[model samples]
Target chain A: MAGVAEFTKFPSESLKVGKGFKLAEVDPDTTPGYPGNKADGEALLEELDDKLAELQEKLFAESKFGGTKRVLLILQGMDTAGKGGIVKHVLGAMDPQGVQFKSFKAPTPEERAYDFLWRIEREVPGAGMLGVFDRSHYEDVLIHRVHRWADPKEIERRYKAINEFEARQVAVGTKVIKVMLHISNDEQKERLLARLDNPAKHWKYNTEDLKQRAFWDDYMAAYQAAFDATNTDHAPWYVVPASKKWYARIAVQQLLLEGLGEFDLEWPKAEFDVEAERRLVERS
Target chain B: MAGVAEFTKFPSESLKVGKGFKLAEVDPDTTPGYPGNKADGEALLEELDDKLAELQEKLFAESKFGGTKRVLLILQGMDTAGKGGIVKHVLGAMDPQGVQFKSFKAPTPEERAYDFLWRIEREVPGAGMLGVFDRSHYEDVLIHRVHRWADPKEIERRYKAINEFEARQVAVGTKVIKVMLHISNDEQKERLLARLDNPAKHWKYNTEDLKQRAFWDDYMAAYQAAFDATNTDHAPWYVVPASKKWYARIAVQQLLLEGLGEFDLEWPKAEFDVEAERRLVERS
Candidate 1:
């Protein structure tokens, strides 16, 4: 029954981005917050499942009965930085019904016609849901900035717009947990090569991923620029080390557990007369 | 390592609705296909998780590579028949990313404005997704029939419309597995009473659910009529005995496995040349 904080060597606060936070200094290979090896980390994750599921159900129940609070887990990472893996392992632990999962690929023609946040705003989780964005609005800032798809002024505007958008979300009771999964260039290369080496994994081996690899430094700098602009107290970013897949998964899981714990979620009080309902059921 | 078929005393085929299927005759307390006790069913569910996950990923992968095949699991039953439990335990075993879960409640103003199928068609899973409807278009027939919300002619028309809609879905590689989680009225009363007894479960208790109980026989007859009309080779109904919670979970899990198995799903062949991608990764 050890709490997530007890299992982690580094508290979640230590992983939080603060003033003068630099993404470059993070060691993607290091298991930040958690001191456990793979086996230990996996065990801790399994242990946290029940607590996490209960907390999530409480949030979902609260939403059903007029609670507006919802958590948005925004994952921003380079290719092979394990964004999808975090989703599969962390958010996967909760009821799929409770999790509003959306993976943003390149914008479609209809999406491109609208403002960037238009598509995003439409997908925000309603009260009592866990909203997950697998490569979300941050893409506008990251890829849009890297490819110079937008003018420098427009790109700068997007950062401000994103901050305000998130602030509005917070004002309306959203707990935004933005995570940047940091992985080394060498690790990315190894993963890409590994995918190529296996036929079964070939479907995941995107040629564009290699093309994007050439711009590794640009993406990092773009991410850093993004973190500097949009990391607010209302919606802070957590820089998770992703060189070790196990560490990345566990850290995100703990971050989510910590996020849900903040709600101090209690199951909503019975709205009906319990005794009367019991009588009604018995008579039926 | 046993296949799902071996664990079940009754195969999924027997559970599937055929000509002259009688909802009244179905013993909700009996574990039709599954012979094992609760503990064994739980164990088997745990064992099937890995294979189920693998098959689902393959289906998802296929969708990414231009495969249009998808599976839609339609869950319909009276209140407290454990629809939510099936979702939590069965579909939950797979990656949430691959499962498109939707719970259809009473239609909204906008939904009521459109044809019932309009709201439904919008939520149908895209290629390679496992779409789940907690309660579906069948509500139009069941509730509508019980209350005469729609005239007899209109209700009859809806049955034809639903069959045609499902036929369209199947024509385009959608495998529709409609399941009615059959729980006896007695079992439902016990569940409702149990919910009322627990403070934590208060949010789940709806006064309307008890009111629905009075119309139980009408609902059952309506379901039988609907089944007799709509059960087709392409999209059929499965009546699962849901009084035993563990039995329902494992049976749905097996149905899903069998549905996915029909695809003979294989990993998509690498679209890119292997040597070329390997060299690119090596150079990067």
Candidate 2:
């Protein structure tokens, strides 16, 4: 891990805090190489998709019976990371109505007036719904720390606030799963260049992004600190190796299924009015 | 329109205006149905999908080249009103990488502290990307109005604020398309009952939803007011008859294609170094 190209070098170890709290920090060595692992990634993604679809159906059925719960999955990553692609394939299997995807942005003047978690809570999915966040409140720590937008003491307070907030959500039965997609700067540059040269995607390029790219090391350091501090059992972080978009999506999908699998989704009893059906049939 | 049962009657001729504009009131008996009479709704939808797919490819190619102007389509409607189905079919034709879908929900403490549009601006698709809002900031009018969370004066102010917000987006070259999936209450009830009885949908059932169902009249009144206040030529509301989910999807697909047709998307000229390529190849 130490001698390999820094872009592909990742620490190979799991951070375990007692029994139920374990952080799977993906090792770059174990991570699949793109194109080389495309076949395996696609197959795994498809398989994960099938299971998600099946479980989602059951989850929906349970929702229809007057007892439904919502699922919120959050994705965090640096620019040029594979959050968009991850969402595309992971949700490829479920019915659209069962899902709601939301991508959080920088706080506006109005948002600035409120506490950090305020905007996030408003978008929580209702029962029987699914909400996906591309970047979430954790930005308070990651981006804020990197940009020096908040005091160190305040950032410290926010880490605990985020953990407690997530715990409260989990306590309320919301299956909260967070994923941090990690991609190397080389890959990021490659993808950004692709975006620059592709006409259909020409609209996505911005001059400002290049300036931000210069601070890659700073962002990574901040991310490492944020992930280390905020990752907890209630809303644990899964550091995904996203050099391969397909494999990243597969891993995230499987993680989601594993988390949601706790809910015994089943078809509830339907109270059909037999007499009303018969009367309607007679009238017709 | 006057005599139909609550929330279930199709106001085939309902006139809708958005933000500081007034449309001629729709009288179901007098207003003509589906004036774009070149083809059946379903056929038109297919054509729209084909065209949209073509345009999306061009758009993504531009995106790949470094353009960031993204498109955002907003869909708004009541429960069982086919928002989900429309999303599935209309967007089914686009490349997933170029598009992202979002659904707005009830405000959390964080969201409540900010203005309604704060969350929305973040969700806007970047250039070469497509963003879809299953339900959007218009909720300020629909739910906030009905619940009296905002005074009438504030509601009135929102009409202009929303209009200006969307127009500013259009000015910046974001293709904004809004679709109101309209369905009759009778149709909605049929669908809801079906969901209840269908074992696959039991998980989607919620007792609270039924409680909301009892206030159908209030919701429709709110819908009528919302469309009346916010519909504009820039982002005209396409009221698709959603009695048939397939047809609704197709209608939305067509509208998307039409909106995207304005872009002059093309591939960029690449500056490749032939000598470098040859030398690199020989070295390998």
Taking the candidates in order, what DockQ does each have? 0.83, 0.15
TM-score per candidate, chains pooled:
0.98, 0.61
Evaluate residue B220 in candidate 1 and report its C-alpha lDDT on the 0 to 100 scale: 93
* Model 2 lDDT per residue over A1-284, tens place: 22222112211123112334322344433454333366665765665566787777666656655655668888888777878777666774676656666678778999999999999989787677777887989888877887889999999999989888888777766888777787777777777667655554545445555667777788877876777777776776767777777667766776667666778766666465534543442332
Mark the regions of model 1 whose C-alpha exceeds 4 Å error after superposition: A2-5, A8-11, B2-5, B8-10
Q: Per-candidate TM-score, first chain only?
A: 0.96, 0.83
User: Which regions of candidate 2 deviate over 4 angstroms?
Assistant: A1-26, A32-36, A47-51, A57-68, A272-284, B1-83, B92-197, B201-248, B262-284
lDDT of 1 by residue, A1-284 (tens): 56433454544787899899888888888876565678787887788888888999999999988999999999989888898888888788888889999999999999999999999999998999999999899999899989999988999899999999999999899999999989999999999888888888888878889888899999999999988899888999999888999888888888888888988999999877788778778988
Encode model 2's per-residue lDDT on B115-222: one tens digit a residue. 888888888877777888989988898778877888999999988899999998888768887777766666666766776556565444444555566666777788
